[model samples]
Target: MPVIGVLPYFKDIHIEEEDSVALAQRVVFPRPGAFNIAVLALPHLSNFTDFSWIERMGSLHVYYTDDPAQLAGAQLIILPGSKNTIDDLLYIRGRSLDRVVVDAARAGIPVVGICGGYQMMGLTVADPYGVEGAVRTVDGLGILPVHTVLEKEKTTVVRRFRFGATDGPACAGYEIHMGRTEAVGGERPLNYVGEGFDGYRAGAGCWGTYMHGILDNRAVVEELLAAAGAPGLEIKWFDYKKFREEQYDRLADHIRSHVNMEGIYRNLRLQKR
Candidate 1:
């Protein structure tokens, strides 16, 4: 029997009926043997909250370890977006975690990098403008033969994309990055924006993309999990508007229980600006 953790209900929603209460409790809680994911901890990291979708699915553990050996047990390794790509890469190298990441990829583990993490998967990352104040090019993990150049043009927008042959739902997300990537000769692209390279998936186990919030796309999550060799997982669709409402309610309730809403609202407002 799998063990699930049932979280308390949000203040706005009430579970008065017996069956509804049980289902809500089950959803709030999760069973054991759930997929474990390791998210690399880099300074100035954001969007940790977006991973709530994964928590809703099953037992998800977050690891902040820079130790390579600690990453070996996770079924999925996520290199999350960071505010400073060059600094994060330097930090990883300082901690000697670069070899760990490469070793994980070589061992056939499913490693996904988003934004700064995505930039780190290439052959070189150049920052010439000193926008990040690093102004130096560094060698990437070399999982993909891609090079990213930090440019004045920053791409920030929400859009929908279709990729992969599976009949799953379309992927919708926001792209927020200061770097532009180009595929080297002989490398395949993962996504395109009107025929421009947006991302790349290397072999069966490694994937990198500039898209943030892609995890919100249930189909994309399922596809990545399947590539990781997960069994018996399927994508299901619901009214997107309704789903967003429910999710906001759930998050509001959860945060309200533990912290003051003033700080949360303030931070969100600043992010929008």
Candidate 2:
């Protein structure tokens, strides 16, 4: 088993105005032997940019992986939200990656499924609208004994949700999914939206939620790290809105440094010529 260490919470990091720029730059760079996290890549993946927050925290090194072998050293695995859940699941199974995730979860590695990833963790998922052009029930990984049905009314709302009895921290995020999940065997629901199932936690290590923008909540990441057995880290309390604005500014700076916007624009102009 990989030895887990708890890092200090966010509150411990005292960030001065002058240090913010340096901290953001340093966070974007991966550290050697840092805790590795594998994010399962889907063809229709979105919101991958959110991972910048994790990287800035310095506790996790995130990588994209579709290969099952990559899961071996990952302390935590993230199944990000996808536009095509059925296709992604089938692609993973076809590559024998489904077994890899199940094996990892069974071995007590932390696994998080968000939105479509959440649906894949259930017993069965039914998409009736043919949004992804598939209307069939598929077997889930069964990490959580839940069932999800895609409804016509798509949920795209930002709201705050109260976490119940969880060890990490209180979390709030935006929901952007069409399917609603229900626990079949009377298990406690992971998330609650006025008595409806919004998320589920299988054990101390594995958790899934329907919220797409949960990463916007630094408290959520801190709690997740704590649950994953990271070293005890201090928690920083900040206005969530202000924190998000800071993150966005930092992200813009990161992109300016790493991405060649000028070169891309020149190339586009040349192509137009």
Candidate 3:
């Protein structure tokens, strides 16, 4: 039997219940915005909160949905990291969403994959040691001409790297996974870590990488948006580090400075934006 996480409830909206809580925790509707982007919320989807900053972006509305119809209108599609790549890949095939994604890719919608999602975008994933559960080999989505071999050894590291070329934007992120992938087709390299290349990119607006938080950087986000056909998107640069500092300061103010009761009252009295 598959395990499921508890469905979250927000405000006064009641979520539709389903047989399994995992699949039931469905669609994350679009926020007030212009661009409509969709992300595949794979079963055992991990590090999804990495997109929190993206969700807060004013011009970008992210939809975390499994329905193929909802995906039809997306400018860009994202395949997020999964805890169990093979099983989640099977889950996607079971739901018949693999065809939807492939069709979308064929129709020119930009698609990107991260970590295990990166693995799934390849040609084949061979798990001879059962590192991610059952010992098996399976064909991937074949979006990228790459092959992955799952192993017992896992790679976990944090580093700052550039997008392969000297003129490419600088990016920082971490890697955590149990497979090593190699490019088999004529796909362009995605990024340069320290001494070697570490991702695959194609002219078809498809990208795959093992790095997490690659989208957190402003440059990468802008580049991806431009490729997705929203060339003139005006995305406000959000300093995530600065925002964290401000939040920490606010928390300290509440704890050390007598709760700032009058300040809260003054804010409440101000007109809404």
Candidate 4:
């Protein structure tokens, strides 16, 4: 079941009733002066919830699509995590989205990858242990100068790191993947986490990292947009926890008015006082 199934209204005039509710619960709908952004709609995409933080300002018009043509004009491009890296990477190749991503990078459009996405952006992914399946190896998008090898031990841990510049700000995210990657060339890492760093920054607008909730960090989001050459798109971060609580109260009000609560209570053998 999805969150929109029960909600009644939506801020977007275009979205149908059901989907609007789902998005409404997750993000602030119809932000003013929204900048267009695209997220690769992979078949196995996962952990996209953190994107809500990026869209919190309502300044980004975010949409998920698998079409390569859609990548042309996006202000920012994100390659989200996947449960199966090789399979999804093959899917990108089969659909020719790999070329689209590479082209977008050449055009200076910001591209950020998380977890499985980071692996696919590398030079090659070697699955010696068959951690992802029968596929032994696959060539990556060849965008970032890195190589990844799938391992048997899955890494799932909370991480704290510095993004964009090494001396910038300390940001926290998580790592949940089944591979190890190493930089093979002059590509500089995107962040410094603990004693080590994460991801590789190919350019001002090009990078990839294993951090799952990288966008949850305010500095990272601002940097991503600014690197995309839109410095005027100011971010206004708000309390998500507070917003969620308010939404819950609104939902409760709607349910109380619309539902036959007394009837439901009686049916459940509870006192309806």
lDDT of each: 0.70, 0.69, 0.78, 0.78
- lDDT (C-alpha) at residue 3 in model 4: 31
Across residues 1-273, which tens digit of lDDT does each residue of candidate 4 receive? 323224467442221122123532332222245576777777787786657666556667787777787666577888888889999999999999988888888877888788888888889999999878999999999888899999899899999888867786898889988999998856588889876888888876788899977887777877787888888875678865566567767667777766667766675785544
| Per-residue lDDT of model 1, residues 1-273, tens digit only | 432334564455522232122222322211246566777767656565445466444335444555666656677788888788888888888888788788888888888888889899889999888778755788888888889999877888876665543232567778877988888886565555443445787854588888776777766776767777874654344444465577667776775666656766777999999
Candidate 3 Cα errors over 4 Å, as ranges? 1-27, 30-33, 185-187, 252-273
RMSD of each: 10.7, 12.3, 10.4, 6.6
Poorest 10 consecutive residues by lDDT, candidate 1: 15-24
Per-residue lDDT over 81-190 for candidate 3, one digit per residue giving the tens place of the 0 to 100 score? 88889998888888888898889888888888998888999999899988778649988999989999998988999968897465588888889889999987554778
Alpha carbon deviation, residue 88, candidate 3 (Å)? 0.6
Instruction: Estimate the lDDT of model 3.
Output: 0.78
How well does candidate 3 score on lDDT at residue 23? 44
> In model 3, what lDDT does residue 29 have?
60
Question: lDDT tens string, model 2, 1-273?
Answer: 432322333433233333123322332222357677777766666555445456455445777777677656677888888777888878777878788888888887888898888888888888877767655767888887889888878898876665545333456678887887888767675555544546887765687788876766765666667676775744344465566677667655655666667776777999998
